[model samples]
Target: MEEKKFDINTLIGFVLMGAIMFWWIYSTQPTPEEIEAEKNKTEQVKEDTTVTNPTTSEIILQAGDSVTLAKAQTELGSFAYSTTLPSAKDSETILENDLLKLVISNKGGQIKEALIKKYVTYDSLPLYMIKDNNASFNINFGTTDNRTLNTKDLFFEPSLTKKGETQILSMKLKVSNNQFLEYQYEIKPNEYMVDFNIRSQGLSNVFNSSQQINLDWNLEGFRHEKSIRYENQQTELYYEKDDENIDYLSIGGEDDAEENDVNWIAYKQHFFSSILISEQAFDNIKLKSKTLVEDEEVDTTFTKAFYLKAPLALQGGELNYNMNWYIGPNDYQILKKYDRNIKEITNLGWGIFGFINRAVFIPVFNFLKGFIGNYGIIIILLTIVVRIIMSPLVYKSYLSSAKMKVLKPEMDEIAKKYPKKEDAMKRQQETMALQSKAGVSPLSGCIPALIQAPVFFALFRFFPSNIDLRQKGFLWADDLSAYDSVFKLPFKIPFYGDHISLFPILASIAIFFYMKMTQSQQMNMQQPTQEGMPDMQKMMKMMMYLSPIMMLVFFNMYASGLSLYYFVSNLLTITIMLVIKNFILDEDKIHAKIQENKKKPKKESKFRQRLNDAMKQAQEQQAQQQKRKK
Candidate 1:
């Protein structure tokens, strides 16, 4: 209360904040109307896709056998499987195609390579490679280079099945050191999951007969490169004991870092992999090892068992392996059911926060998603709920502010009484007394806001991984899935660069309005300390303007969704504050309460007494030092 200092530095900081906000608003003007139009366009895109049959392919599948192929590029690395089933009315060929880079099919059924293709987007680029445009998968059945290898006979041999009863389709491969190998496959119709069995008969015999039998199986024309990742997590290379062993793992090329990459597992790049589980333990499984053949004409055999393929050779002892192959998307609900830890593939938040994400945030978000199909709407609803939950604490903060306002007049009087004192102890004591009488703490408002910082940070982390919000439209934003820009600049600016986004502008405006409202309240009630001292009210007014400006400048490049939430929250807070200030808090009641407290002669706490004593001792010490110098 010794003359409240009006610091020039505070005013300068505020001006800078305002400048920043103005720059941002000028750059990113709002396109609220455009966002609505984009929403309409998104619906039309879905409708157009349904009407167009652009993916209609003419490949046919017979009743007893099945075939799978990829229709993208020369390499059919993706998968397209077809099987005909006899329904009561008619025969239908069930074809399931879905592509996800890193996932196990156990949760959402068998993952075919075809379904994992994801599209990339950029600010100014045309989408090339539309889905299902590969013309190369059309196979001439009897031709060797037909590319689309038929697994029908091997999996669904008509002679082995009954005429009337439905046969569950399957395929198995047995390789021996014998000159010729007989292969068979069974076919099942209208089924999503498939199991595999592969045996390398007489493996020890083949090992003894030949120097070494190199088993190299390639899922050619399956149109997909494998991705290594845990369930419901970011895609990263699988870690192994030896880092150098990465050379053996031939997934996709490093040059194509934008998409598929070399996973950590030694041999998991080419679809799913499993070694022939013989009673004998094998030493190692290598990837992309070059086996230079002196004679190029040697026959290479291909065997199919469900969605898997393996090369067979002769051996001394039979080496057999069994495995359930899962090739599917990283759908959390679907994968959690398999108990294979398959849900770890989604890019949910990581670390202790990740634990919170999985345990608390994800469940809450999923629940919200169930009710609101539109992700943008869901985020808005979620924000409202969180705000409501925190309302009580927020109200307390307002109460603290109101009480401080009531004590300002008395605080000013005490400051005037201590006009000539270099001893700050008396001034501090008077200020504390005023605060105690008013039942207000200086830090109460700041503490509540600080407590909510973690919640804000957690929400920031949660939104990006929320794929459900991708391509969703909110007010002035085109794709809540990506950045929403109203205009792109012809030239780049120094700190701000170019590219204007409307959401940030709207957010800045809202922030400014809210700050102005709050600042007005704080300023109008502010009282000056000494006669010559500058009013603290004016300095606070400058600060109120500055902070919102800083926010506007900084948040322009941030996600529209984040800015939207903040803008809405601030607006609501301002509304609530206004209501409380006008209808609930009255000056007469506050003054009466203060007078009542003063008449009662409230007892000081030990901490307050200690602080007052310390200040008094410091003031006396300084006075003694001054007297000695005189």
Candidate 2:
């Protein structure tokens, strides 16, 4: 106040206080219409939110509430219900026998879960063929009220009855006091088959008799094996129609098929199946199957999903449909007992290979399993038995190789004599003559090996589908039916997979050594090479290495039992080769025998004589071509 002059800070504070006071006064005032509009906007959002999210009970009630009894009576005439509607509270009833257990829900009056009593999944949990909203069985029809109705949304009253060893569960959907739609399921002790029958009582007026009822059945196949990829590769939908051959969908991808007069439809998994068989054939059926990608959150427990829609014919005013459901292991003997050709789902193989597995391998394996508890020892015994049975053929093959080895020096002489490319035919003829004189057939080695191919292929089909090997463990393998991983990789390797399987690696190593031993024995044999022909030794060497690598890659994802069989088989073969080389076969004796045969008068068979004639003709033609060129 000395000079009555204000500083810059004091002037700024006065201006800021005046501006704040003016803003507060302006915000406190509002019009009546603006407040009403803001309240209306907030109410609108609350109404929209309520409409979007509804409770489960509300959804269930909506289905019934959408059509009142008065409206139904007006549209349906005398068929309308005057009683109270069924409750929406879902309930489940279980019907279990010694072999299987089924949970039936009131909502659809269908099977909500199916569990096999004797088997468990790969994770040691109870095996569920259908569960967790993955299966749906519904009947779709037009009601008297002209509304398309799906039986899945309606609740049914369930009743249980028992007679001796059979248990019957009946679900009834009442249309009136005495009229109803009924589902009767009968389960017997120690049986995997369930008898299912649908009957209608005095409901002819309520249903549209002119139209056929559509039965929609769907099931998602849960994973029961250790490898989801393998299980998916084996899962498929199979059906039989018109008492003819059984048909199936592609096992790899999504596919659908239309069929007529279907007798049964089977949802086949890797080791088990669920089949629906009709007493009277369905008129037409449409089936579809889809492979589910592996996802830990959603699909890790399932392999594929299947859908089937079949048409059932209704007669007079009532519908009576009879069917059976088989939910059990895919055992060949057990399925064959049904006599519906359902055993074809086992997929042992095709043609003679399948026949061998069915006729020979299955019986032998089962017989061995009866006495031997350990699968590993049984496999060893099986290998020994097979080798013993095939000893004569193996001996013949080895004898052929021995003859080639003993004659290597003379073969080299023949090769040296025909060094030029034009002399190939002459050298071949001379070699054939020498082989004939020595009583050795050039094809002897390959023919015996070829004869054993059926057994090999038969065993290839045997191990993977053998249910007994499913969870059996041996040595380092926790499950013989699945690949035995010694080490798991963080990343997948293109064709090799994401794990190192010990059995396949051991099998590959055995094969490599076996090839090495055989290759060394045949190294001295000389092959005549033409100008454009590839080097035989190099090709053979490449095959020796490439074959084992291929075995390692291909069998890495195959069943451990199969790889174990190969490993043991190869080791036995190598052992036999060593035994033959050391104690059974002597080079001196073989050479002496060959020399003795050569000294004798050589008798040419018709085949050898014909081959010699052909060689001469070829040589003559080559000579003529050379002259023409000159």
Question: Each candidate: how many clashes?
Answer: 58, 0
Off by over 4 Å in 2: 1-89, 143-145, 177-179, 201-212, 294-299, 316-318, 522-526, 599-603
List, residue by residue over 109-162, the lDDT tens digit for candidate 2: 899999999999888899999889989999987766566666776667788999
* Model 1 TM-score on a 0 to 1 scale: 0.51
- Most accurate candidate by TM-score: 2
Candidate models: Cα lDDT each? 0.45, 0.83
TM-score (C-alpha) between model 2 and the true structure: 0.84
Q: Write the per-residue lDDT of candidate 1 for residues 394-486, one digit (tens) a residue.
A: 777777677777777777778778866563557767788777765666777667777766666666666644555544677768666445667
Residue runs of model 1 more than 4 Å from their true location after superposition: 1-114, 117-364, 419-421, 494-497, 520-554, 620-630
**Cα deviation of 371 in candidate 2 (Å)?**
2.2
Which 10-residue window of candidate 1 scores lowest in summed lDDT? Answer: 223-232
